[model samples]
Target: MKITPLALAITLICVLAVLAGTTAPAVASDAGGIVGGIFGALIGTVREGEARNDWQKVNREVKTCLSKRINVSIGQLVQKAIDPTDPRLRPYMQACEQQVAEANAQLQQERRIAGLRREQEEAAKEAAAVRNAHARAQKVARHRELIAKYGAKIASDIEARRVRIGMTKEATIAAIGKPNSREVVPPSNELWSYGTKRIAFTNGKVTYVGN
Candidate 1:
């Protein structure tokens, strides 16, 4: 068979059309992959953002709950301390108040931790060492005074206060007068020492006391 120019041109056009049609789906598939990648990235970004927000919200709520508990404990300690009818129990009550103050101060320090976490989570590493040193120094001073003033009573009261660790410093002071001495716990900016008991304060609130 002899081919004419018109026939050749016609055959070329048909061949091109078939090739284009055959490859159309593959082209569409590649384009689809790009679009899917973009969509996936967007979804992941949204989910990560939401997770961060939820974490922060939960942390705040937990702190608030802890604060309320600390306050209630302090109030109870004050009530117990003021009841002169139980003179034997007064010392223990005073200790409880001090523990509460200490706890409140610790909580305040934790609030600082939270803030630091928000700014730079790594800050906790440095902050922890500083905090520990402060706690140790305060503990030493508190133990010395307790040994000097209350003697055996200090140990007994401390044990009792452990059972009731959420008293306020104000109530403790009201019950036992001013502290014989006071010292600051580092990093937390809380006070600690011994007079009649161990006490801790944070943001002017009593959070822990110990006999």
Candidate 2:
């Protein structure tokens, strides 16, 4: 009286197989087999979907219990499969806080050390600047003394970086800073090379200046 979906599907398959030139007995057997296999596959898929839904429901329940700090679900402690009970949250949090505090303290100490190093470097630079200033003041005093000793014309010539015959070795050095190389010739003569130029000195007095 009541034709189910499975019965209807089998009847349609049988009609199609018969129209396709299959014998009635062969069509009946092949249609039955095909319909049975399709139904079996559909049933298996439904059971798999139901099992997945049940797992998701259980997982949500476990998460809800943990969020509420219930610490247990379904009359049993449902936690991660690994390390189910070791290292509870409160102790773990305390340990984590201590580690954070220690890290902050170490960072502060390193900052202080870096600040001290910068201060030392600044102090060293200041000390070097002071020494350079004192040396410059001494040079000014010597230059003034030289101007008073030798006439202003000779002092001006030296200050203008000129090398002249009869100029003392000290005057020549003050005029042109220092020579690149110095060699002593035989019998107390000195030859000073300044890049492409050369100066010859005898008895501490300049005798010749030429390139």
Give the clash count for each candidate: 19, 0
Off by over 4 Å in 2: 1-88, 156-161, 165-170, 173-196, 200-207
User: Model 1, 72: alpha-carbon shift in Å?
Assistant: 74
lDDT of 1 by residue, 1-211 (tens): 9974445545655555566567788765665565456555555555455544443443334334433644533224333332222465445445555666677789999999998778775667669888999999897877666557545454345534431234345434533556777777665546556655667776554667666
Tens-place lDDT digits, model 2, residues 1-211: 9975556656766665665555577766776677667766555555455544443554343335343564444223322221222355445434445656676789999999999999999999999999999999997987898799777777888878898998988889888989999999878899999999999999999999999
Candidate 1 C-alpha error for residue 157, in Å: 1.2
Residue 122 lDDT, candidate 1, scale 0-100: 62
Global fold similarity of model 1 (TM-score): 0.21
lDDT for 108 in candidate 2 is: 100
Q: Looking at model 1, how many pairs of residues clash?
A: 19
lDDT of each: 0.55, 0.71
RMSD of each: 34.0, 18.1
